[model samples]
Target: MKQPNPERTPILLGQIDTDNHIATTVSLFVILLVVHRIGISVYRLYFHPLRKFPGPRYLAATELPYLYRNHLKGDWVRDMVGLHRKYGPVVRIAPNRLALDGSIGWPQVFAHRGANQDEYAKVRGFLFPGDHEAIIAAPRDVHRRQRRQLAHAFSDGALIEHEPLICHYVSLLVQQLAKRAENNELIDIVKWLNFTTFDIIGDLTFGESFHSLDNSEYHPWVLTIFETIKGSAMGRFFAAYPIVRPLVVLSMGADRIKKLQEHQIFSKEKARARMAAGAEPGRRDFMTYMLRDTRSGEKGLTTNEIEMNSPILITAGSETTATALSGFFFYLVQTPSAYDYLTKEIRSAFRNEDEINLRSTSSLQYLQGCIEETLRCYPPSAETPPRVSPGGEIDGRYVSSGTILSVYQWSTFRNPQNFRDPDSFRPERWLPTSHPLHDVRFDNDNRSAFKPFSAGTRDCIGKKLAYSEMRLIISRILFRFDYEIAESQDDWHTSQLVFVIWDKGPLKIKLKPRTMTE
Candidate 1:
């Protein structure tokens, strides 16, 4: 080895010093990061505002547990049922969120806050970003205006006017099922129910039907809606962790975004066509009532508003109704006694299928009870609709402003405190006290806790239409046929994965024509 030169030795020492300095800085940064995370965990567990609340320490310490159960597992509804059971009525589901069962929670969180207090605001992130505000995502003033404008269309009078159109689709549904019955075929009742409701809503919203009933298959637009919902459910994960939004967007790929855009464009096109066609005489479609307000020079919906609300109407009006009806049959067929009782009630109430109109079905008390019980057991919209607290009292506890709160419908409906035999389906629980079928055991059941359509100013706008469709279709189907659930689909109701709405699979059933006895 050559003897070291003085100049070279200094240069080499300087290089080594620089390398050591970099390594020291990196090590210091990592240590600080770990310490900071530990500090946060300690604060969240022992000193945070929500610390007094009861929940798993892990859930209170970080949002990861809640996210894993809800976004990753897609079984938050079932998990909520279990959470309430373990933790009591109120559960600290996340670091800053509280999930309350609906008894005191619904009225407190969703009810009017009184003239002196501000109403709890809707959670903004829940609504997907869009150019125009539909009623579902509108700010309070905008929501009030939109609700006012569309009120007439969803009113009792409008439902009466729209009855014939609804009846027409129910007839088509019966006809389609009749064909399947002739062959004694196993039908996916969920798909057929979806077809009927989508066609009905498509016609009402666009002033023309989707022809799903005529084609005996799903319309392309309807399929696009399902795809959009799945994508939206995935997008929620990003919404919860905005720091990862860019990565999530990239991962969603261009195709999904393009499909969503295409769905919006199709909705806009249909709405434009309906607007161009002006109201026809005797036409009682949803557009007719909405456009009537515009023609009368009232402050009705604008063309843009109509375009924006059309898709909301399609999804909200169709999917929910179909889900409820599907749930009704799923539970009904499993409980043979309940099924037979409902069949007798419906068939005896109407002499023939032609007589099973909306009005006729409305009077079938047991039929209504069965529908109510289905809503309780398998609500169409099972997820929590979070609201930001306005520094008010909820369930007798003072909630600070900016805290997220929700009365999760699934938890509320399944809570044993809210219903006797909560896991069991008993339509008799919904019957009037004096009614012959009424069971006194359910007399103590907290009926007020059942808000399947939700409550307050923002309750479902299409509730009347949904009930009308369910009543007519269920009554007619039961009147004309007797059905049994396919053995493979015994777990249909319990085995679903919910993504915003349910990730429903086929609900297979076999139907036979009711044998007429003189």
Candidate 2:
């Protein structure tokens, strides 16, 4: 510093050169990466296997749009409808995914495997990221074994025995709502419906009730299940880029991961307890059938398998039934004539509250029609159930191997091609005979396109049980109380966040006890 040492000049210049070289190299590398990404995107848009399919440019080029719309915005179902409307029945939702809205694609993709036809299995991305493969999302071979064991638990005979237990819970709901009505409370009917269904499923599956209805709050495990779903929905956005998924999961922090692990541990312990104790001799629960061997003495599921499938059974059985019930009531209340008609149907059919049971409610045509219309209008699974082609043709379209094929349920159900005035609630469309308002448009609508439970081997196994729960709960509620919308919910169905299951908002309804007078 005193004299600017001449000896140090070369060293300083050399250091500067070295730093410049390093910076240049890094900049070059970044440039190459950006160039490569752009090249890939262009290829996807113009030369990829799905390039011929119609879709928005951004969605067809990269999955970022999908991630943004589905995970971040939580309105992918509505987005699907818009895409189908703009681009016709088949649209490229991703670089490799095709969403089908046409009627033929449903059976072609979801139908049972045949001798001449190729097999289509569930997409691997549907599986829970960190757990034993649950039966609902398992691969074909694993699913076959798991379904065989669990089928007995959900069998007609099993449901018959479970019916009494179901009735007991429905009775509790009726009593609870009556109390709420007496108190002049504005209740969240959706929450109560969820509590009722969850309690019944919890008792049946875990050998005890969650007591959500009794406690007037969600059980910790049920809350955990829903949080898990939200986390999962976010995780799926990264699933398209499998390489980054592990890092994304790790970044979710220790607290969330620990909570998820704790829930799994709790579920496993409960399942083990049920297996050890066995079911009551005359009255069977879910565990009883799961533990019992098939007629051929085929082995049942492993402890881990039963533990994994238990959560699925509980969530599927409870959440879906609750969604249908809440959605049905939402529409029923808005359509005063339909609501009056349905209430009359229920009240006239039941001589007393005790007389209402699954068997007795089965014959109510208007009740069934209301259920169907609700399912059509607000399906619990509003998004497409993606299927992967083993390699073959789907409705005359030759899709490349491993291409994702999905039928957008929301779009198809709402399509004018499937139902006339589809947005308007019309339960009469389900009646066997022509609706009095029928026209050529109504006659031509493809009713077969409305498959709420899906179809074939992968269809919802809990279909019959779901119907039973819906019928019993709705009838019992209508018979005991009359409800009015406590507040208006504009676009209730459209606003719901669907992440595997609907994250529903409160359906606030003011209830009044049904009075007998002319």
- The local distance difference test score of each candidate is 0.83, 0.80
Q: Across residues 1-518, which tens digit of lDDT does each residue of candidate 2 receive?
A: 37877899999999999999999999999999999999999999988877887888988878887775776457777767777878887888888888887486677777777767667777764635533377777877788788877888778888898988999999988888888899999989988998899999999887789999889889888877766666666657766666766675676554554566666777777788888886453467788777777678875777777888887888788888899999998898888878888888889887888888999999988889889989988888876557887777665667888898878677888887678898988877776554443335455668878888887787888999999999998988888888888655856766787765577998888898977641
Give stretches of model 2 more than 4 Å off: 1-3, 115-117, 125-127, 130-132, 241-259, 279-282, 434-441
| RMSD (CA, Å), each prediction | 2.6, 2.5
User: Against the true structure, whose TM-score is highest?
Assistant: 2
Return the TM-score for each candidate structure. 0.93, 0.93
Q: After superposition, how far is residue 191 of candidate 2 from its true place, in Å?
A: 1.3
lDDT of 1 by residue, 360-386 (tens): 778888889999999999999887567
